[model samples]
Target: MNNIDGLDSWDGDRDQSVVLSEELRSRLAPPLKIGNFSVHSRVLQAPLSGVTDLVFRRLVRRYAPDSMTYTEMVQASGVHHARSLKKIMDVDPAERPVSIQLFDCRPDFLAEAAEMAVAQEADTIDINMGCPVNKITKNGGGSSLLRDPETAEAIVKTVVDAVHVPVTVKTRIGWDENEITILDFAQRMQDAGAAMITIHARTRSQGYKGAAQWEWIRKVKQQLTIPVIANGDITSIASAVACLEATEADGVMCSRATLGNPFLVGEIDYFLKTGKLKPKPTIAERLICAKEHLQSLYDYKGKRGIYQARKHMTWYAKGFPGSSELRGKLCRVDSVEEGHALIDSALASLA
Candidate 1:
């Protein structure tokens, strides 16, 4: 297999040591069939709230056109009453194989929202049962659903009945360490009409901490016949390969790692398909991408996009000399021009 430019194979990490077998390669090479729908790439871009907007998805799609991308999670109740669609649910006609993720405890509301999502050209309807935010869970949404399997199952069945597209779920292992009930929860979801499931491998309490317990993913994959996509801590091609081998999962999804690096999904997809690594972006190249991200954010969402771009800009300005300093300044950028100038200055200094 070929290695990424400027980085050693496995990035010199011994833990990433493993060989891709012919069997595993064969499984991943075929299009991932979710119920009746098919996705050409096994690597998916997770529906990150406040991050996986149109601008971000465009960047990722440029690199991994065949990969399935998701819209940010939208509130089912919010969509139920609104006459017009929420901006979050908007899908460009060109971005095929996009899933619109919805979060709520009300089966009726979720069913209604799924219809709206389908009307907006969503290829699939994803129930967000894995989000760990306090606001989301307090209202009986997100990871809190792990503790309420009956409600979660009902939501899936209702939405499945409501939409023509396949219904999928994204969830954690359980509410906490002591409550790792994904085995039962996953089986219930599949039985209730979910076409596919993505497991984050962390409990609700872990909240993005600790190592993702991929063992649970293996267990879930074994119990369910539906497509299982392993998520959490998938930061690189090596990690993606490691997770797939360890869990024998049907696919892998990139979450936090794709925050600034939209190229991640495509890179992994290319490796999986051809056994050749995509080159890592240089400091200059990354900064250029960052500048483009800032400009697009401003163009798409105006000043509010600039505020959101702050976090994205900081995510990109890392790993190089003076990057920490650049991050500090970039996060406070008040205008698109300012963001462009700062990234340009950092690129020049790196040269």
Candidate 2:
């Protein structure tokens, strides 16, 4: 298989060994057996809409080949009735050991989507019960499931029976502070046969605000028989370590943090396994990745590729000088050449 810039191969960079030796106080990792799949890596890539596309996943897979990655959440109702959704569910062969996440509250529709995911060669099917968007909630999907555990569990039971693959769930603590029902709700899901659970430690009302409630993750882990994956508010190596240390979750999944930094998933997974920080990618490395991402978007979407790449380029440009202005310019780019020139100029300024 041709590697994208040798993504699957890494010899570790300078100080890699030294850093590994420094973080020897190993955290207890929960070993989860979901159906016939076993993941040795603790950090999973939480499915983010529009962000966890095939190209973005390829970037992340390069650094953390074995770490579990997720596609952007697929709408089951849409997938059941539309060909466009099926195209979105497509996974590259290089992204083996990956899970396809789906949303919607209808058990029957979700079941059909699950079967489709199986046909597409997914190792697992993930149900999304944590999205807070008004549209999704209004449709009785996403975080709205928190308001109706009965329906959520039914979706799981139906989907589990429909597919031979393991079915998992990604959800929040509750719909809002007043509706905290995670402990009981999670138990119901477990009873209904969800193989694994990923809990983003905040209520839907919080909407990615406040500190992630690591304590809630600890509570779920203590209450559930399956592996409990912790997510939310983790963006850096230190935060990743802290999330694991505080929650005692079986694994950590980086959502927004993995946005521009594809190397994060593998870097953290490697640190957990070998206790080391791989060498940081330099400015040149970032520029190369940005260009490759631009080209891939072009390949994936044709003339509209520039529009799709704008957000990705903006995400990659974070933590650099003139980033915000560059993002504005990138968002307005209508051609691939212009996007490339903007990124090249940004990289040159950094040098």
Best by TM-score: 1
Task: Estimate the TM-score of every prediction.
Answer: 0.95, 0.90
Q: Residue 152's C-alpha lDDT in candidate 2?
A: 92
TM-score of 1: 0.95
**TM-score result, candidate 2:** 0.90
Best by lDDT: 1
How big is the positional error of residue 315 in model 2, measured in Å on the Cα after superposition?
Answer: 1.4
Model-by-model lDDT, in order?
A: 0.88, 0.80
Candidate 1 residue spans exceeding 4 A from truth: 1-19
Q: Against the true structure, candidate 2 has what lDDT?
A: 0.80
Off by over 4 Å in 2: 1-32, 83-85
Tens-digit per-residue lDDT, 175-214, candidate 1: 9989999999999999999999999999999888788999
Instruction: In angstroms, give how far residue 130 of model 2 lies from its true place.
Output: 0.7
